[model samples]
Target: MSTNKEMKTATASTLNQHVHPFDQLTGDEIIQTAAIVRQAKPEVDLVFNTITLKEPNKQVMLSYLGWDTSKPRITKVEREALVVILEKVTMKCYEAIVSLTHNTLKSWTYMPDVQPMLTMDDMFEVEELVLKDEKVIQECRELGITDMSCVFNDPWAIARHVSHPGREKRLMQALMYMRTCEEDNQYAHPLDFVPIIDLGLKKVIAIERIKPRDSKYSRPTIPLQQHNFLPEFVGEENYRKDVKPIIIQQPQGVSFTVKGNEIDWQKWNLRISMNYREGLVLHNISYQDGPEKRPLFYRISLSEMVVPYADTNTPHHRKHAFDVGEYGLGLCTNSLQLGCDCLGSIYYFDAVFNDHNGQPVEIPSAVCMHEEDYGILMKHTDYRNGRAHTIRSRRLVISQIVTVANYDYGLYYYFYQDGTFEYEVKATGELNTHVLAEDESAAGMGTIVAPQINAQYHQHFFTMRIDPMIDGQNNSVQQVDTYTLPYPTGHPKNPFGNGFTSDYTILKDTKEGQQNACYETQRFWKIVNTDRIHPYSKTPVGWKISSGHTAPFFAKDDSLVAERAGFAKKTLWVTPYDENQMFAGGFYCNQSGGDDTVEVWANREVQDIQQKDIVLWYTFGITHLPRVEDFPIMPVEYCGFTIKPCNFFIANPALDVPPTNKKINHSVLAHENSSKGEGPKSCCSTKL
Candidate 1:
């Protein structure tokens, strides 16, 4: 891990080298880009919000990458930076494009009525500003919180509910909590009042108190209870003693080779990069089959996500959080620890982002890469000969964990030996809790996890941006569903009543491209290239996507959440590829009023997506109804989708995988049974 100063010195020496277009910008690039903007606008001070790479156009990269390897490769490519700047004096936002290759500012435009993504510095300043406010201090004193140090606040971005002046400003609500000590968990003691801070004034504009259920209302006192999850606080002696540690050792080191940002493992090859908003991104994914390197996905990343609380009451209604757009996930990423975050032959990739002062800050171990045992891949047995064959499965995992205030999301990408890939989001963290009202019941719209803490019902919706190059760039989506033949029992097509077949529907345009999951029909979508077809199957070479556990958006159509996060309304969406259309929730969503989103884009102008360079946006989520066991902290709850080869391969892709061997596995029997050795003398076989 390189410190900021060390990285600055290192980047200064390496800035002249030609890096890949997909590679992340070095620290020197960030510093130089910021300098260019400051030099051009010397009249006022600038607050740097974000400075990231402006990715090269897809068409240019496709042509550059398609060049023959035998000939000299094209080495000239444009390097530019996209910057979001806030004027310190005017309180206005501006977007700038800087040509890093030429050391010049290319363009600058003012963004009207839009707030950029919240920075980590902005969050820290909110806490300090709240602690020092006289009104906040007086309110805390009335609630028996005399010490300002014991008061903790979580800064949350407010969702616009009306066209009022207050809603138009850059504002954030501070959810208050009380801690008994320095190490105590503050969530168990949620306060009844919340402080609203205006970023421009840097002061608390108002303090909104929780509404009383009856006419005889009084200020409620803060709960002075402890619900700790740390081992020391929760009696370490009460922990289980029977649990044993199982160690995984790769004596011969790892099976993957990494050259710069690119990794090659088992037949898969891909490049990985981290963005300031989107944490981890994979590019140019391909699989090696013999001498041919087949392209799969051009780029894949978690585009946007929103968590909308179900409570309809005041204050709580504004709890909808756009974690990706409002606050960058990359900024919240944890410095992953070995054994705690990942295990066995791990490789960590550090991420870099600009601070409020336009200096480069590095988050060490922002991405973790490793291999995991995936049980069995394939197994078969011949009963007559008592012969059995088993092949163990192994998968490569690329993952990152981000902490957005109270909740943590573990984003992972799993690649298998069978040319299959999966994206999973593991949600586990402290539930955003509140003070339960004395007159309300826990069963209404929230659950009382602790004595007085009400953990409200919330749904986490995530959208994955998939730019697939299954066989080639031009592809179409085929929605496949299985249905029973609509014929009489005695008809020729349905001699048996149990007969069923798959129905394939090609989504031609954006109007009909919006789709939902149908449990009764076993629905799945396939990304296919019509230019090529399997010789035997007589079908387009393709990859199919099957959604795992999912749910529908529960908010009303006219609600604020629906207008802002419209991508969650459907499970699948297809649109013609556009470089600027990276975020599903628009570019700026800190205080957005629902005008720009995937739903608006798809409906704004219908475009033919079939047999064209297209993009797929998949939305999936989990509706979390809090339980008693999820009090102090929550266990990992999983939701994801899988992509597998449909007819892209000629046959079973893992047929050639070698069977497991005792010498290689080093297995042991728990019980020393005399018949263990004589039971089955299995021979490891490899298919020709």
Candidate 2:
């Protein structure tokens, strides 16, 4: 084991590469893992898949979290083990899970290691698989194309895409493109031949080509040589000089202090870590409640993001992607630059990702922590008495962004001074673009952007994993809604329709807890710690979950997406804690059709969710309609949900704030006795 000094030095040395200590798999470790795996299984027909650091089981991690300082035991950080997957060169592709501790192979699990057939095919590179097929070249020959270029397509929404009905399988489709090596616009050039290949057989089962209706061209073809679509700014055009926001800092500097990954504000105390799957994780998050550091959430993270398109056409049907699962969210994180991506005394966090070859690479400033003025958060005014009260709000924003192919998704978790936890999601960047004819109309698939370009329509759905501990751990879900009260015995005022009452329901079982939103009822869900009740309200301390911009999965119940991603069907899901069940779409969802996700786990009819360590999954999405402006680039659209305090605090927590007194100044007016008198001579003259 490495010593503390050695670990610190090692971490500092990797800072030049912008690598995080725990987030990345070191290059040295990867090289050593490769050597060990080869040595362990020397003479086997093994197709190496991935070798990565296997996160330790929760039991072991819990040991660290619950470590007793009074026990007087030596505390040393241990390195995580490695898990390598190797598949046999067979039809079913029997895979083996090889577990290695330090440098020694500890165990292997292979019940023939039969691949789970229900969901996506185990993780594999779509582009690599497409390029490896010799039939792709044959399809190119059939199209009379000599140039070698390929555009990959994902077969996520279409099950019969590779075969007939009732014969669904994991498949990937490839769109053969005509492009010369010297061509400047490779993406613009298109040869309309799509080959649907079975992932298991590695063979082209069918080829769907879009031929010209009037036989105008012998072979299906698109605009050959188009102008470059890549954006370029020459000279000083790329630089920002005259227009920039000036951020003023206080003479005393930032009020908050960050020691390593731990952030300390007025009340919030939490530790953070970044990973390839989940970009940012806040652990041991709690507020200073009186004497002890009261635990609110043990851990909170952005779990899975599924962006399923609405187009039912051939090419667009295979366009869906599991943004977080298929391509790791942290893996696609953008390296943010100062002054551009962030401002005002920002603290940037680094994320380390293991490339396809298992080599560690660092993305600098993958996550940023900064504070922004959120205007007035809390206020109380007495109109009759000329007395006023307010507390100006400053919100600490922790944000991370990931660009998967064309769309850019931003994940933000906000912490306010008044015990409010908010989250925001921003969608920007370009759409999954395509080419169209002059009068094609594009049907219901997409919209026309350029002369012959049909920028397809799509939807982006996101699910946030939240495990709340409101005051204490033993919690239950309380379903609350507003309902119309019975009209008073045919009273004349009954026609006003102004009577209503609040309804409270203790969600008994899983079925009752998994209810959809009702617009008429105006509903919200709350996770309440039944053991911890508020003194004033005489009710359990809880936080309300209110979501917006939510779009449900539009695919048919018998559709591929329905079978594969059942979690998308409902907006909210409540599951009892299962450490293995993390993602809503499931792990290894590359060519997955739907067996490993939360849908599968929820199907077991597991009961006793209430009073247990419960997990809440809020699925929110946008129904995107492509416009001409959405073609080259899209405007930033903001949509998100909030987790606000409900019966959790006795009084306004911001009531203790020192008055900035920006709204009105009664002191100077009273002192001067003049109607036109200004505010106080000193800002802090009045005792808040």
Give the number of the best model, judged by lDDT. Answer: 1
Q: Can you write out model 2's per-residue Cα lDDT over 562-638, one digit (the tens) per residue?
A: 77667777778888877778788766555565777776676678577778788888777787878877645678888
lDDT of 1: 0.85
Instruction: Estimate the lDDT of model 2.
Output: 0.63
Flag clash pairs in model 2. Answer: 118-594, 119-592, 119-593, 119-594, 120-591, 120-592, 120-593, 121-591, 121-592, 436-452
Separate clash counts for every candidate: 0, 10
What's the alpha carbon RMSD for model 1? 3.6
The Cα error of candidate 1 at residue 66, in Å, is: 2.3
How many clashing residue pairs are found in candidate 1? Answer: 0
Model 1 regions more than 4 Å off:
1-18, 67-73, 161-168, 214-217, 671-688
Q: Against the hidden reference, what TM-scores do the models get?
A: 0.95, 0.80
